[model samples]
Target: MTDKLNFYFETAKSAKIGIWEINLESSQVFWNAVTRDIHEVPHYFIPSLEKGFSFYLEGENRTRIKRLTEKTISNGIPFNDKFQIITAKGNVKHVENIGQIVYKNEKPYKLIGTLQDITKEQNLIIELQLSVEKFSSIFSSANDAIFIIDTSNGLITDCNPRSSELTGYDNNELIGLHNSKLFPVELRTELRLFLKYNLNRNEYTLNETCIKTKSKDIIPVEIASGKKFEVDNITYLVCYIRDISERKNVEAKLNLLSLAASETTDTIVIANEKGEAVWANQAYLDLTGLNMEEVIGHKPGYLSKGPETDLNASLLMSKAIKNKESINITILNYSKNGEKYWFEVNITTVFDSKNNFVNFVGVGRNVTQRIEKEFALKSLLDVTNSQNNKLFNFTHIVSHNIRSHSSNLSMVVDVIENTDDINEKLSYFDLFKEGTEKLSESIEYLNEIITIQQKTNIEKTKIHLKSEIEKTRMALSLSIKESNILITDTIPDNLIVTVIPAYLDSILLNLFTNAIKYKSPERNATLEIGYEIIDNYTVINFRDNGIGLDLKKNKHKLFGMYKTFHGNEDAKGIGLFITKNQLEAMNGKIEVESEVGYGSNFKIYLNEK
Candidate 1:
């Protein structure tokens, strides 16, 4: 029996547990080695009930342990307590103690108990409790209304303080209430159906809906709900609700503004101070053939001009933006398909309420038909001017030719009447014949000009460019060879032009003849002929290294009737005028670029068909 008891005591000591007992009648106490070690006492130190009780910490813990031990000893009950104790070494330790009374003759005699040093376990439990308290405070004090609802019955099971405040209700008022009652009357039915569907499908839904406040007023809310669950437990709905009344009002105002802008008829374009487009009304977008997305944030100049558009319009626009004033002008513009048109544009600068420049607004009206009428009037004026000049030149030529021929005729008649010799008579006859021939030539030249004017109907055909150039060169071969000119043919072989055959031939012949006739005496004449396609029209260039005219002095009359720059004997001064007329008759045009002493380049534009 002693050996077994010793083994048990050894086991208890090895396990770091302390055992103690006390007698209620004698107030005696006993303790094991482990218990003595826990108190930091010497092995031979005797323990009494009073001393054992004193080992407990002061304050509530000491009182608690003492009362428990006394009750168990006097009333034959059992007591268990977890408390703090201070050892002899002045170290604090956590202990769990259990005491039971040992009854003698059905009455309490002594109490026995076991004590466990549980300092580490007690500290861990305390840290866990603190962490739980921190999380609880955050959950309860959050601003967003949070609720846990029972999925089966749609009842509110839990709610945060914010939820109660937002609903104008207390925790007790909301705890057992159905969640559907919080929704507006019209939305409650929809929400109930939605919940049922979501439960069946096991999916989450986030949406905006109206909620009824305690005062029966509907408030816009955005609710995000999802399932919350634990292992082997039925899932409940967790919802977070936010007020969105202000956002909804802003969106409604924006929608109204958009609709108003779209329906307005006036062209409205809003651009930043830098001339970048910010917004445009529907009328403006439709007129410009551009979408809002394409124009926004882009410079308005990008849509107003193209390759062939007048550059002056862009310059004027820049000036207007810089000056920050309303500018009105008629501008030539290009459409999306490269068709040129005109617009009467009014650009005004917009300012903020504080009187600072903010943006520019440009309103434009298409004036293409009006400008076309203006061009037609100008062309008519040009034709009238040409007719007046032609009449004047013809009068001069007719007087000079007729007067010269009549004088010769008079001399022939005088010779025939006065001299009876056969040789004199024959000489007079020959003089008359030569004079008549000269008269016929003058009449024929005049008739040729009239014929060109009358034949305005241009018969278009595909004329090979290289072949036409070679033919012109062959016709003017004598002039080219005599002048020792170097002619470079840069005309592409496959290139062709659509024009009347007669007009094309006349245009080329006149240019070739002029290039040779105007050859520089000091240098070998160089002529270059080439062609290119520009905007659906074929442009043929004839360049000559000759004594160029002073274009600045006589550019206006360079292609006018009876105008001559060089005083060469063979200069009729009618070739360029005739060439230009012929080109115009065939729906073509001619432009000249020249510099004195360098050279001249005559460019002809013809349709490609």
Candidate 2:
């Protein structure tokens, strides 16, 4: 019996297993050399039952050993368990301990068990479970089906629930099967060959293939294979399979919509959220005479911005889109040939699922024809209204002036009819002749006013400002010398303006004639005519030092027909009225400034270009 025990203990020592014994009532303990080595004590060291129990860790491990020891000593109950122990040098070790009560005269006397070092196996188990749990979390949570495959044999080692659900197979039926079962027979060969090639590359390989379900329905799928990895001495290939049927459907619908957009007559533009164009349809390209290269990555108005582009309108559209609001506006854009056209564009802001701006879709239609029609109608209406008002004023003035002369002649004829002396009758004849002459003169003046108002067509040419004024001054040289008028022309020598030739001559003649007619009774009359440029516009300032009118009271009637201020015989009040109308016909305006007794200044603004 001792020899057999020695053989078993020698074998146990070679395996790094420890053995122990406890004697009841004797209160003694025995540990083999193998056990002493596990506890980090000397080979010849001996221990009592108390010292043997102390090798166990405190708390649970020690208490468990004590309970087993007491049961064996009193009741002969046996216990087998694996637990922890602290070495003599304070090292934590995982070990298995088993104990059985030995019978001596039918009463329990000894308890023994084997303690083996299981630290390496236990730690490997923990590490394996941790890796599986981490990978399982990703596998199950992912939307796409994920599979773990043995790269060498092309066998499915593990797969997520999504893979089973997608293939209509349960976990029991899917594991240990070949991955090629998911594809058709013809594609299985291709897939297997593809795996062979990609495994050597050690990177992902993506391919579009068909996957077969349990019902034999072939569904399109996007298959991607990851590089091989080894865990626990087992090599695995991670594969991703994504069903692409929904994505293909979405793309098909988008292609149809794109075709529709191109076929429509209205101009269409699709752009990213930043207002940079990504796509422009056929109409937009044709309207601007631009190709894709000229339009893409550029703003909508960038191609059309010129001297006439409405910056305010473009700015408003930008602000509206930034705030995620749609805007509709009329924009004027120029084509490649420099011809201008108008389009009424409606832009809508698009948002994604998270309510973030994604794109701006704009649709525009050519409205140049409608705009031209409306402009023509507005011009006709304005011309008709002006003509009607002019006729009303002409009729009233003509009737009043002509009726006065006719009434005076009628009264003179009445005196002649009742007179008895030839001398009185003869006196009435001179009066009759004078009244007819006055009526004839008024008729001629009315004809002249009508002629001035009848002018509609204005052909303007560039004329030197200083030269025109000098010509008029020379024509009125006699009147200027008689009135002692000081004519000063401060206009620049190079100043030129576009004006109707006849109107420019007439305006200058009226200005000078008025200066001579309205000379201040208090001082020698002075007149200044000069030109200045402002905002690229030629401004002609006609300043006169003369008897200025009470503008506060007479301003309303200053340019009225036949209105006079100085009551001079030559002040027909027609020159200023003609001057004002002529300025308007030429797209110019006249502004006057003066005090009651100070001089008057007339400022005329005209286009410089």
Candidate 3:
């Protein structure tokens, strides 16, 4: 019997199968060489009945095997099962367990079984089962509705729970419903035909259509679908339905907001952190006097700021933005035409959820009109204050001059009446007439000053600056010839300034005569007239080589009515005060550069075209 068992074991071993026998009477276990190898034990190793069962994994496999072995030995029953086991070498394996009980004298005798490794086949089966479960879960629980239909008949054969929930229909009510019932007939036919023709070429195709719910409400859905051929000679298709009503609503609101930004009057801009303009609204283009093509891909300063822009405000903007801060400030800015404009600009920094700096948003309101009105009011106030001061000074000078003339006439009358000589009396009468004439001349000079001050509506016309200077020199030809003053013009012939013509003519003539009147006794007098464009003004410089005033002592008196600086008898001081008033009325400015006994340079700034 032993040799016979050896023969069987050798045959089974060669075939890579495992065989075993269990003695019911002695509770001993016998394993063939192949079985021992399957259990990963040496040839001489022995396994008892308990040990043999333990080789099977704990829990289900071992419990099942032991129960079956007990039944097979006690009742002479046969058993066949597949189970997993952990080998002696600590490796997991799948195996088939087949056993039969042999009988002797009407009772069970011993148990014989065969074991075979089926690890690869068993693993593949388990994986397939898991895949099916995963797919079933997704199909039933997915957010989007899913439908399975028979392509040939366009009948909905099955649908996931999500489909019924999404469409407001019971699961049973959706079965066997034709696809056309869910949509308008025309759309249904078009979509079915499209799916039939193209489903075979790709994994999925998409179609956008509206579907009617059970309540008869129509909502848009996006369907993505694919098809497969079934063994029953039917074409089946699977579809995914996504409801886009909420997304569509959001898009409409976004479009409305975009329209508002485009049409609104406030200038809007989107810029990178570096202040390069990337996007701008129509108002921004209009505010800057620039077109879209000229605005984008450049600094915002290219359109809104320039050399005359307020540097402090720009610094504050840069500092705030660099620190990811939002700021609002009123700053000076220039337009494309070099016209000064003002904006109430608000800058906000954009950041992500993680608090990382993204970009900057700027909204600018064109506040030029408001700021210009403010400056106009301020200028008006300044002029009123200045005129009031001049009026007070004029009142005092008039009072004093009139009193002096009255007293001198009284003295002359006394001298005339007390003298018996008619010739001396006539001389005093002549002196009295001369004093009255002087008072008349003083009144006329006061009237001229008042006339210049009253000229607040001076109209400006374009005139060549050099041409105006030459005309004024001709008007003072007598004085220029007597004083032998050389007048040279270095202004460009084409240089133009917008000024009140009378004011320009008067200003140049006064400056020329003043130079001649105050000419140095030791040196020959010369006047150089020139002009250049500075910012928005044409600066005409009248530099003369003549006696200069001590500005430190007579700075305020230089432009005062009837205030004289020099001891020259011809220095009535009315000329310069009138000239200053005329320049101011034309919205011009003047400044003096002078030193005692050196020379005077008067710069007249006029609006330039």
TM-score of each model, paired residue for residue: 0.44, 0.72, 0.69
Q: Clashing pairs in model 3?
A: none
Clashes of 3: 0
- For model 3, the superposed segments whose C-alpha errors exceed 4 Å read 1-16, 21-55, 87-90, 102-110, 151-154, 186-188, 198-203, 229-235, 248-435, 454-549, 566-570, 585-589, 594-609
> What C-alpha lDDT values do all the predictions have?
0.82, 0.84, 0.84
Best by TM-score: 2
Candidate 2 weakest lDDT stretch, 10 residues: 451-460
The 10 consecutive residues of candidate 1 with the worst lDDT sum are 225-234
What is the TM-score of candidate 2?
0.72
What ranking emerges by TM-score with the best candidate at the front?
A: 2, 3, 1
**Considering only N, C-alpha and C atoms within 3 Å, which residue pairs clash in candidate 1?**
none
lDDT of 2 by residue, 174-241 (tens): 88989999999989988887888778887998999999999998888999999889998888888999
Candidate 3, residues 533-594, lDDT tens digits: the string is 78988888889888887888888678876778777887877788888888877777788999
